[model samples]
Target: MPFRSPYPDVEIPDVTLYDLLFTSLTEEDLERPLTIDGSSGAETSYAELRDQVNAIAGALAARGVGQGDVVALHSPNSPAFVATFHGILRAGGTATTVGAMATGKEIATQLEDSGARLLMTVSPLLDAVREAAALVGLADDKIIVLDGADAFESLTDLIAENRPAPEVSVDPSTDLAVLPYSSGTTGRPKGVMLTHRNLVANVAQAAELLGVRRDDNLLAVLPFYHIYGMTVLLNLAILKRASLVTMPRFDLPEFLRIIQDRRCNFVFIAPPIAVALAKHPLVDEFDLSVVSSVFSGGAPLDGEVGGAVARRLGCSVRQGYGMTEMSPVSQLIPAGRDDIPLASVGVTVPNMECMLQDPATREEIPVPESGVSAPGELCCKGPNVMPGYLNNPEATSLTIDDDGWLHTGDIGTVSAEGVVTLIDRLKELIKYKGYQVAPAELESTLLTHELIADAAVIAGYDTEGEEVPKAFVVLQEGAQLTEQEVMDFVAARVAPYKKVRQVVMIEAIPKSASGKILRKELRGA
Candidate 1:
């Protein structure tokens, strides 16, 4: 068990999305010095930030956005994203934040699917939002910009007037707080409906599991559009009262400089960022003495670089696993648990249930009660589980089974100690000569070898007949490893069916903003 609430649960007040705003404003927070928003062109005290949140939340209520209404936000990491997100949730409407770098097609697809009635965006990306609005038959006026003549100027004005946040009774168990989207395993993006209870429970789980504290300066670079960033960095940070260092885009020089300048104590990272930090030579410029730990999530990290970065920084480096469906957190490695970065994504967090089941049958597989399950589809259940999908009942039925379990599409295993190790993606598994092969397993093996900077594994077919595993590799600069040498390196490790029949040396791996390798895009290539 973790540290108990200093105050009784009933007396402490049930945490809601907007409750933070009010508490931050009315309560004394001399402990938190101030916040520097890198994405926004200004500075703010925690007290001032609370007032802005109240203004925006009240402004949203004035516009008649109420319970169950869909409010979308499309912008980079900025103060607007926070205010708009809090405003939408506090007003009782579901908040959906789309990836800032999403293409017109991806944006339109998610927009039409979510049935969002209103959008908040920056001036730079207005056209794309407009295109998405048109796809869903929404009017141009529904597309609200942050700056210029077409800006949605209502909420900012309300903040200036200091209006009370709209009066509304909210239940943690029932009210919708956020509607983050996830692909689950296949098909297009569908909105995962998360209630206020789901979010609060997750906050408690993360705070206890990760040992988040108020003094930790955090680099919150993960996109708010994704659940991992929104929950772990934004909400969890608020609960712990950590100072968030938000950066809109990823430029290595700038990202590194932010750490050095701000003296960030925590970093929420994805696989690509982990790889970059491990391989980049300029990383030595910064003093990371205060960076107590770095948390990697959303995607799996290479054991090689994970170990390298841990040793290089002389700091705690850990990984987490989750999807939007499970209120976004399934497992996380505890800080300073051990020397080896567990190939597993730590263990399932407190209060959440995770298991491995036969992928085809959906029956639970027997394994150690705690650690990682046997290699199979991973499934979870908890209060944090989403109620259902938005405007898509059929899709919801498919993701969450009749038993109320959120079936994660990834193939994984759990050890006796409850450590969850993900070996493959269910959809990405290749059947070579009727034997099953996990692409990620091969990729991890290849990446663990020295001289290989990054690797991607995908299935391809030969002209004669069979599907085969192919590898795309980016070798470290000045390393003289040949294709044959790389293939031989893998040949020593596993079964014949898993061998890389073909190899392609590439300069980079194609990835999404969330840092997941675009296997579909790789197939097209």
Candidate 2:
């Protein structure tokens, strides 16, 4: 289907992502006020945000963070972090997001990889940030310290004293805006480079799909470092002029408190948060009658749990799907289709094209016209896709072809109704006795049992070097399910080879900040 934007062809920003917001923000919008909270709330009208952007841009330029230079932010989801991204863009430099939980060694590697000359980190992390900075041999003048280090004063102070950076004309299509990292089957994180045009398009595309209103109150527990939160909630909030409520960490009781307190209408929740809302007892204590919808992403959401949450909240529980390399959104569940199959990830976003392919040959397969079809790889191409992975030519070449299609390593098919149901991952799918099995299927089925709380599935090899399905189960607090009983439960629902031959009851499974289970860790262990 052709994209139907009321503002279609309204012209994406002619500048960088930060510059876009700086120039397009209006005084009227600012007057309504925007609040970003980390330690506490900082209220700014759009006008103030724009003005500060200009000042920071100037300060950065004065300090030599000019065009093409990469500046890395190692801070959490704070106002400074958001401002720094725009500031770098306005100064004609590219901003890079560093995982806040990254170890000093990992931080050093990314800084070295991106050739980052400047780093912004909160005070408490100064020691780690300094060590990383030293590894790259960054100078004092290049560090824009926020809160943690006493080396540089507050960004507000510097911006207040500096003249606005000289505005330079830039073509959005060519200027790199942000660098976020994504890992492939190799489990190595590569920098995903998104240009100004890419980020702007994703934000607009998100607003189109999600349909934000000025009055919508969004609860943002998702980290800004992750593309999902950065694009869908943080950036889109500004684009749509909606109010955003944020928390640093996911605390179930406190999370419920904020929603009940703010009457938050829109929610950008990850899979883990969805799990809590669906099964955690704290959910019953709070009244979420005001929530309008919740978008779950960053990992596979079990269909059964997601639907139940929607019913409990009396709201639409939708899923928006993407990776860091796609400016974060390629498909979103349409508003009125909340009642569609709970497992489906929704249709391709408007202006985006999707195809299923044979993973080995990369051949496109026809979309299924009826019920569940044979699974294939998901491939996508759109303006919202990232240009390339930063400086990793080999990785970029493999991820995006010369023809411009981005190969998603997921295995799934699009149904006739245009709904997408994930079948398996190309890397995680288990081949057992000449048959294919999806770990997610076994995991999802395991989660549905009243006793099971968390589950991860992997392929176990036998003495003959043959593969069999294995499940690692995490039971809810004060609950336990034995291995044989759990295996029998999954065996009854799935095929013979797909049945769990081994079941291990784990206390907990580690997860990334974005809510993806650390499958690689499980395999290594």
Candidate 3:
């Protein structure tokens, strides 16, 4: 039998993303700071954000971008990103957010795959954006530089038009809102099709659990392109009417500076940042006493690391578990619950059902009467779950089953009290500093090298105990390549996080009869 969420279900509104977030704002909420740009100390109040969103939506509508259209947002965390993202959704266009660190080729692949009609990016990334836009046949006029650039239209120009936002009808249950790419089970990245209801339901399910107060200053260091940051940091904050202090990127001194200067009370971090907070000497230099809680996600947070940070900062430290296909949050340690184990991802959110099933036998593993249940794939069914992957029904069928349970390729055990603890991953994807690094994507890139005959990649632990992509390469006859050379070659081609960290020269890459790389054999070796 499936284990249901202990909390009572929350009512999810039947409305579009814009209406769900913007419509409920009161006069006091409108006057509050919605987004604060950490770099420039510029703030966008709720009223200003709404106006900017409307202006951008109106301009986008004027350009014929409406229902069923896709616009790719490629930029770091900023006030403009928040407005433009909502603007796209308000205009009934699906927003496909691309990572700021993505290479031109990577961006181009996403642009083409998502069928994005327009590209929005910052001036600093104009070179890569131009390359990607050109590859996808996007004309110069199709690109909207968020920050002003030479020979390009800026967000300021759009707002200057002062056109009224078109009244667009959206079916929340069916209309796509955001298309975030994820490497599900095993493969290169595919866009996860999250509907307006998917996101709205997730926010409603997680709102009480997250405990983000309206007065809380939430730090937004995590990249908003990823679902964890998109839903949790951006959407959830906006819905709750909290003040968001945006960090463009992670810099130790700068991150601490913003928290200290802005007096941010809550922070959402990945495991890597938690590690730094736990042991880094620089952390002691800043006064982080204002932080009431620190929530970690994207990758597993070590119990000791969480404990260390909790002790060091004197704040509540918690973690959660989910994927892009599930609006990125299935289980979270409810706010103010210090009783739950730090290693556990806590109980399932409201309106969700979870089950443990043996991967090999496909037998349901019932919850143990006492202690913890046996490790199995943690499958979940919920309104927050994505309907399917974009344009890939086969992949969708493989992920979400006939009965609606989405097989989250993670091995976890649930306690009798409903506390869930993750053990290991059954998937082939690597979590490097909380970023998904697909092995197949790296292997294909490696095979493209002239001297590389074959390659296989697997999750390997670094000296710091962080998971990284370690590649096993079979060079061509009489060819030689250094580990750094291989790493450098991949570094030049892919994002910095996806670069092959460790390379092992091998005679052959082990494979099964079907020619699939035996990743388990590599992991074992």
CA RMSD per model (angstroms): 3.6, 2.6, 10.0
Per-residue lDDT over 306-383 for candidate 1, one digit per residue giving the tens place of the 0 to 100 score: 877878887788888888877788788866677334577877776767667898886777776565445778888876
Summarize candidate 2's per-residue lDDT along 1-525 as a digit string, tens digits.
221222233345455666455456566777865545623555556666667777888888777778788989887766666666677778888888888888787889899988888887777777787788777787776776666346566676657776687667667897788888774334788988888889888886667668778888888788888888888888888777887777777788878888887668888887878877888887888888999888898988888889888888888888867889899887777677755676888777766777778887766677555765556888888778988887778988898888787888888877766677888678888999889888989988988888887888888877898888888888899986789999999889877778999888788877888888788778765
Best by TM-score: 2
The local lDDT score (0 to 100) that residue 14 gets in candidate 2 is 51
Count the clashes in each prediction: 9, 3, 0
Q: Against the hidden true structure, what lDDT does model 2 obtain?
A: 0.78
The TM-score, computed over Cα atoms with residue i paired to residue i, of candidate 1 is 0.91
In model 3, where do residues sit more than 4 Å from their true spots? 183-186, 428-525
* Model 3 error, position 208 (Å): 0.6
> Which residue pairs in model 3 clash with each other?
none
lDDT, residue 349, candidate 2: 70
Worst 10 residues of 1 by lDDT: 1-10
Cα lDDT listed for each candidate: 0.75, 0.78, 0.88
Ranked candidates, highest TM-score first: 2, 1, 3
Best by lDDT: 3
Model 3: per-residue Cα lDDT over 1-525, one tens digit each:
999888999999888889899998899999999999887778889999999999999999999999979999999999999999999999999999998878898899999999999999999999998888778788999998988998999999999999899989889999999998873225578999999999999999999899999998999998888888899989999988998999988888999999999999999898657756876678889999998899998876768767878999999999998889999899999998889998899999999999999998999999999999988899999999999988999989999999888999888899999999986667766888888676756875776676776678899999998999999998877788999999999999999999998889988776421133667678766
TM-score of 2: 0.94
lDDT of 3 at 189: 80
